[model samples]
Every structure is written in C-alpha cells, then in structure tokens.
Target: MVAPMGYLPQLMYGALITLGVALSAVLFGAAFGLLGAMAKLSASRPLRAVAEAYTIVVRGTPDLIIILIVFFGGTIALTRLFGRTVEVSEFGAGVASLAFVFGAYATEIFRGAIRAVPVGQIEAARALSLPAPILFLRIVLPQAWRVALPAFGNQSIILLKQTSLISVVGLEELMRSASMAAGATREPFKWYLAAACLYLVMTGLSTILLRLAERRANLGYERR
Candidate 1:
C-alpha cells in the first residue's frame, strides 16, 4: 500500500497525544516526588522508611515491567472489585506507569535539592519564630527549585523520551504511529527517520525552554 501524503498529519496527531501524556505524567510525578522527598526527610522513621521503599522498589524495577503491572494488574483489581470483567485504558496505564518511574527518580533529585538549601537559613527562620509553612514557602522552596532545575530538567526530558514506551500498551502515541506507517508502507527508512526528527524537534524545543527558565531562576541569586 502506498503511504498517504497525509502521514505527516497522522504523525502530528500522535505527537500531540505524546505531548499530552508526557505533561500529565510529569505533573503527577512532581506531586509524588514532592511528597516522597518530604517523607524521606521527615523526622518520623516510618515516613522515611516508606519513602525509601518507594524509591528503591520503583527504581529497581525496569519500566516495562511496571507498565505491564499497571496495565494488566489494574484490570484484575477492577474486575474483582466490580464483580465483572474490567479493562484499563492504555492511556491511563501508560501515564500511571511513567509517572511512577519519573517520581522515583525525581524524589531523589528533590531530596538532594531540599537538603542543599542552607540549614542556617531555616534555623534563622525558626529564630524569627516564622511558621514552618511560611519558612518553607518563602525561603526554602524557591532556592530548592533553583538548585533542582538542571537535574529536574534532565529527568523531565528522559520522561518525555520514555513516552515511546507507551507504544507497547497500544496507545497511539508518536512512536506507535511511525511504526504502523512504516509497517504498512514498507518504507521503513523514511517513516522511522521522520519519527526521529519529530522527537528531536520536541526535545530540542524543551531544552531551550528549560534553559530560559533556568536563567530566570538564577536571576535573583546572580544579583546578590
């Protein structure tokens, strides 16, 4: 079959799906990362232990295995709960799996960034009798975000590229679209090349944006 000239449009549709999934995964992952980081830093031993377990287990497992578990195991759980056959959508499973993996790594990044915030500042906040929330919000978080930006950006890019893995779950994200086009037309080189270029454009744009944000984040410190 001759591949349609509209293949680019199909790829664009898939690209949009990829973008949506990646953004959703990162937002959800950031929540987990923040919570996990705080847990790891908590005074409560139980909280620390739970956080450790999460990072260790998720990081220890390959992402594909985790994707499979969420994709299939979720259905099983839902089936039992509802007393009927239930299915998990590929989009849901893919996003969840990616989020879990991204969170595990981001947890460590956040933990280190939080700790990198000077302790004396926190102590001074306490000396001034500032409430904990105010101290964290006003002093700690801003600095921590600056410290974490480079690492966080790198991890985010990795998560973006990892969106390709969702093709396995049959979500028609970019890579899957390219693969199908290639298979159908038997023009493997051009289709795959197009996919690679699309990915490069996506990653390149993100890198530029991250760099701009990093510069903005540094402006305050650079002034001092």
Candidate 2:
C-alpha cells in the first residue's frame, strides 16, 4: 500500500504536542502528589480527610468525564472570576485536566511510599531530636523515593498514553492528526499504522529510562 505522502510532518507535530502536554502534567502533578501524600500523613484529621476525599473522587470517576468536567467547569469558573469572556485553549485545558488526574493517582503512590519507610527510622530521627524538615530531607524522602519509584514509573507511562484522550477535545494530538490524515488521504490503515509506530517508539524509550532509574535506586541494597 502506498503511504500517505504528506502525513509524516503532521504526525511529527502531533507527537511533539503529546510529549509537551505529558511533560507539563507530570511536573505539576508531582507537586500535587507530594502535598497530598504529606496531608495523608498529617496529624490533623481534617487535612487527612480532605486528601482522602480528593483521591477517592478522582479515582472513582472515568478519565474522560474528569477531563470534560474540569475543562468546561474550569472555563466557567475562570470567566466568572475574571469577569471577562476568555477562550480556553485546547492545549491548556488538556494539560490541566490530565495533570489533575495524574496527581490523584500519584497521591496513592506517594502515600504508599511514605508508609513503606520503616517506622523505626522515623523513631530514631525523633530520638535524635531531628526537626521535621531535617528528618524529611535527610532521612524520610530518600528512602521514600526508592520505594515510590516503580509505582511512579508506571504512573508516568499511563499519563503518556492518556495524552491520546486529549484528541477528544480537538487538541490535534497524534491520534487526531492521524485521523485527519486518513480522511484526506482516504487511507486509514496507513495513517493509523504510522501513529501506532510513533506511540511504540515513545513508550519503548520511556521503558528504557525507567529501568535505568530502578537500577540506580536499588544500588547498595541486598539482593534477595
């Protein structure tokens, strides 16, 4: 089958958009994840409850619904606050929606990692009179990262694939662009196969990076 001649450039553009959105979402999501984890472990009951509620609600809903609600609802809230009509860019909405979803799932990963840190270690830190900040920085966080890495990597991969859903909002992601190419060329199979190959490349590279991180993190640990 003759490949669609001009589809390559458009597919490349969509690939860049997908990567850009995922990268932004991951950075912001990490901040939300850390705070959510800290609140989950907080002494204040209200704070813990609020964090729990956030995770439960987000996880319970389908990702498509969450994206639509956050996108449309966010636009309405922003318009009311600013008292001016402003159009929300599809790219911006996609980033915020995906980031919110990613953060909710990351809360679980973070909370588990924090719990995995040995209680004895925290007790020893308290016995040594280490301040909260010092203890978290020097003792708790490093160990938590080691425990959290595998889950975090899985979440990262999920988020990357979730970028495809942004096409529903007409964000011109890889899938959307491929669809457009197929329509113009009247060759759906050719364009879709190209899109799949691009996705495979992105995911394969991510897997390699994750493996490297796992190796470095497990350094000096006793092999089972």
Candidate 3:
C-alpha cells in the first residue's frame, strides 16, 4: 500500500529542489511585482500601459504555455541575439516562466494593497516632513505588507504546486522523480501517491508558516 522506504530519500531531495524553484521564482516575481505596482500607480502613461499589458498577457496565458515559450522561445531569441546556438537550462526556464506568471498576479495584489493604505496616512507622513523613501519604508510598505500577506501567501502556495509543472521540462522535481521511479518499478499508483503526499506535506507546512507570518505582520493592529 505504501512506497518502499528506500525511495523516500530521493523523493525528499526532489521536494527540496521543488521548494528551491518555488522560492526563487517567488523572490524574482516579488521584485517584478513591486516594480509593476509602482508603474501602475505612477502618473506616467507609458509606464502604466506597459505594466497593464504585462499583467493582461501573462494572466491570459496558460501556465504550461508560458513555460514552453520561455524554454523554447527564450533559447531561440538568445541564439539569434548571439548569432550562435544557446541552451537554456530547465531550472532557469522554470524559474523565469513561473516568476513572470507570478509577477502578473502579484502586481494586482500589491497594487490593491498599496491602494488600501489610506491617503490620509500618506498625507500625514508628508505633513511630518518625512522624505519619500523614509515615508514609504516606515509607513506605507509596512501597512501594505500587512494587507498583502494573505494574498501573497496564497500565491506562494500556488507557486509551490506549480513547481510540479517544471517536471515537464525535465527538471527532475518531485513529480518527475516519482514518474521515473514508477516507470522503473512499474508501480504508477504507489509512486504517484508518494508524490501527492510529499506535495501535501510541503503545502501544509507552508500554510502554517504563512499563518505565523500573517500574525507577525498584524502585530499591534486591530484584527477584524
């Protein structure tokens, strides 16, 4: 009914790789999202248009398609740019693709979070003669983060699960490892079940950590 204990270590390693990919993707995505949010909120029409276009295109496309495009299209583009063949690693492609997708969604989340911060608070910060950087660092970002945490956490969990898609690109993540094991052992059900359980464990732990982070972020604030 259960997989052989011998295979557990390999699956665990694969899970670690999966987590690494998710974290890297999320970090890169968050950076992009921050920039996108700023652009969306800026007065510059061209910047706003570009950010809007990025979100619309990424959100409209399927994740699998995005992954394939980045893996194949990126290689082709790089080859053309360099006038030589270029090979893109599965890991890099996976991270970049997922980050691009994540950034699109995170852009809206951050934009909404930023907007949720009361205009009065910003006015008050300016009233205090605080510099722009200090005002954002000390006031705006803290509140925005508190507001964004739940949505961001949800996105991170989604990102974690999305790492499985990288298996299609031959990343040897948990799903890929399990599939290979299943093929060798001819135990599809057992290996797939193991992979599912590992994913559940990862997601479950992430939920707990996210809840803790949410609580920490909400410290000294009234909870509704």
Most TM-score-accurate candidate? 1
lDDT of candidates 1 onward, in order: 0.93, 0.90, 0.93
Name the better of 2 and 3 by lDDT.
Answer: 3
Assess the local accuracy of residue 190 in candidate 2 as a C-alpha lDDT between 0 and 100: 90
Relative to the unseen true structure, what is the C-alpha lDDT of residue 108 in candidate 3, on a scale of 0 to 100?
95
Off by over 4 Å in 3: 1-6
**Tens digit of per-residue lDDT, candidate 2, span 44-160:** 999999999999999998998888877788889889989997667889989998888889988889899999999999999999999999999999989999999998988998999
Compute the lDDT of residue 11 as modeled in candidate 1. 88
Q: What is the lDDT of candidate 1?
A: 0.93
lDDT of 3 by residue, 1-224 (tens): 44566677878889999999999999999999989998999999999999999999999999999999999999999999999999899999999999999999999999999999999999999999999999988988999999999999999999999999999889989989898888777888998999999999999999999999998988998867
Clash count in backbone of candidate 1: 0
The C-alpha local distance difference test score for the whole of candidate 2 amounts to: 0.90
Please state the error at residue 3 of candidate 3 in Å.
12
Question: For all candidates, what are the clash counts?
Answer: 0, 0, 0
Off by over 4 Å in 1: 1-3
User: Candidate 2, which ten residues in sequence have the lowest lDDT sum?
Assistant: 1-10
lDDT for residue 128 in candidate 2, whole number 0-100: 99
User: What shift in Å separates residue 78 of candidate 1 from its native position after superposition?
Assistant: 1.7
Reference-based TM-score of each model: 0.96, 0.95, 0.95
Residue 78 displacement in candidate 3 (angstroms): 1.6
